[model samples]
Target: MNLASISTKQYVEQRDKGYWIAGTRISLDSVVYSFLNGESPEGIVQNFPLLSLEQVYGVITFYLANQELVDAYLKEDEAEFRRLQEACREKNPLLYQKLKAAQAQKNSAA
Candidate 1:
């Protein structure tokens, strides 16, 4: 019997929303971050029900094999997110302040 083999390239995709699991909306960052935080492939699959254990493992392998490149992409992505967040805050200071206060209140309650 013959089994099909899949390429790592087929597991991850670079889209406008950054690196994502090829056919799904789940981000590679989500899996990578969870793995880094000590979650097992099984655990990751649990967190992202859309992903299978095979997909999670494949993503992890891809991340390990291209760690440096992936890390750089993640850093750049984070910077872009921060930039957009700041722009939004600047454009809507009142809304931002309200959100910030709400967050603080929530945190304090915790």
Candidate 2:
């Protein structure tokens, strides 16, 4: 919110009305995850061609500033995705159990 405090000197206001890494093609969540996993900013930018150096840095800045909230959102999304998957499984437990058992058997055999 404070332009003076923003070090990036340039950023795009995101869909969340939050500023993110300046030149990235995807959300900062993906960038943050990549960065946390040891991906370089340039590597991320190169991997996502549409993203620019500025965007990558901006995303890093944003991620640093609001990491907790972003992490929470990611966690929430994961939980929701899992919940949906569980619902699908519940809808057909016999089939799901059979598939799971088969996968386990295959895994054990391998």
Q: Using TM-score as the measure, which candidate wins?
A: 1
Query: In candidate 2, what residue range of length 10 has the lowest lDDT sum?
Result: 16-25
Q: List where candidate 1 sits over 4 angstroms from the true fold.
A: 1-9
Tens digits of per-residue lDDT, candidate 1, 1-110, equal: 33456433489988985899999999999999999999999999889999989899889999999999999988998999999999999999999999999999999999
**RMSD in Å for all candidates:** 2.5, 5.4
Clashing pairs in 2: 21-55, 21-58, 21-59, 22-55, 23-55
Give the distance in Å from residue 85's predicted Cα in candidate 1 to where it truly belongs: 0.8
Q: What is the C-alpha lDDT of each candidate?
A: 0.92, 0.76
TM-score of each: 0.87, 0.63
Which residue pairs clash within candidate 1?
none
